[model samples]
Target: MKSRSASKITLTSYDDLLGGVATLEDVREVAIDELHSFTDHPFKVKDDEEMKELVESVKAQGILTALLVRPLKKGGYEIISGHRRKHAAELAGLKQVPVIVREMDKDSAVQAMVDSNLQRENILPSEKAFAYRMKMEAVKHQGVSGANSAKKVGKENKDSARQVYRYIRLTYLMNTLLKAVDENIIKLQIGVELSYLSIIEQEMVEEVHDSTGKYPSLEQAKQLRKHREEKSLTKEVIRLLIIGEPKKKTSITFKQDDIKKYFPPDYDEQKMRSIICQLLEEWSNQNH
Candidate 1:
């Protein structure tokens, strides 16, 4: 008896394999090199654990979803979404990944890009700052009737429009300060207040921090801004304001070795104390 022959199965696109009808026109696999990131892409494509997991997923199971892209006038495609997926695919050693092409104007593309990435967790403050700014501009360019473009953008993001405007204000901060905001070294509320300062004033604040080893409290930041508006924000003023008045002593202690190192080998405790008092007096006079 002859054995029954097995049926041959031909595999095509993932969409086809799942018994879903392909729209054919929109989705296709394109060379990775042919795709470019959206202009002024606000989101970071980090090589962190999340990206590592994404690469592993693509390597093992393949990209389950297609990227959204739009064709450029000259040639190639610009990624409106899936920037992270595209980076993961590259790391996965795929020569091409699937994408869905859409025709969109600049404003439409900006809105879409922001909307898509905002859903992700772990978004940095810097990313949200620039993204909110871009979206606000795009909303304005679309000729939304009111002056409240931020409000319109907020509606799309499910956030309060005032909150959106506050985020956008962070874009004015210098990169170093902005990074501190991202790291939470500078809290968001204080960062917003600091953002109102001019670049020169902000640099002065940075200088004060470097010299004194202190970051301004929220109250200090507010005072700094007030002085700035008064047009009396000098470096000396910044230093005085940041350091503020001396507070009551909490505790004071000195390491014996540290004190000994600063004095002669035969110096007694009294001698060491005398030298310390002299040095501190000089320091106090110079600071005053």
Candidate 2:
């Protein structure tokens, strides 16, 4: 094949596309104060040890990569990525940082924000929950089907489509229950089952976990959903599912066969009983 002649790139052509403003790929120094967090940004910018390291790096070398931002009608730029880096720059006492300006609508911005942050290694369940939910809605707004949206969101983060939908279910949970999922007190599957309950019902479940140190097993959570569907999941029903029915003047009864081996031969029955009570109280406090 014959070699094709190369065409020269013109700066004027780029300026025309941007309506006589700076080009899309232009890296400009924006004052740190002028950059704002993206609206309803799902990802967190934490000040943990990793953030401290980022701050130190910024202090020494400045920002190696430019942040992605778009101009807002309100005068400041909205950060689409590099929230942690921007925070680090603030902490590192930098007055300005480099940024690349792009024009994006809200839906596109949400998708971009989610895609960039999902690449992090140490994200919480709640973060993934909200981020996936946001990105899925954004995709659907752009006219994608629910299944395809889930697939696209999942592929971006190496999660299965089913897993993406599962994560989004967690968005239904109340704050306390969601925090429990983040803390691993409630497993993901159980959280999904519990998520079907109404907010008031979830508040009851949170109460059960708070007053008594009991969380739902997977089967128990499924049963809770069954009761929820029947519209009979009251606080009393929740309590019963969590800790089981109370005995008449419930006692910490121990079967002699099961209890004898745990205590020393020299210990009296009263002493063993007291020690067991003390241990149970400690466990309760820890869970509380």
RMSD of each: 10.9, 11.5
Clashing pairs in 2: none
lDDT of 2 at 33: 96
lDDT for each residue of candidate 2 in 1-288, tens digit (9 for 90 to 100): 111111111233223223465433466778999999998888888889999999998888777666778899989999987899899999999888877688989888888788778778988999999999999998899999869989998987899999999999999999988999999999999999999999999999988888998999999999999999998889999999889988788556668879879988888889988998899999999999
lDDT of 1 by residue, 1-288 (tens): 111110111123323222344343445778899999999999999999999999999898777667778899989999987899899999999988877777888888888789878878888989998999998888888887454897888887888988897898899999889999999999998899999999988998888888888878899889989988999888888888879776887988888986798788999999888988899999999999
**CA lDDT, every prediction?**
0.83, 0.84
TM, every model: 0.77, 0.77
Instruction: Give the TM-score (vs. native) of candidate 2.
Output: 0.77
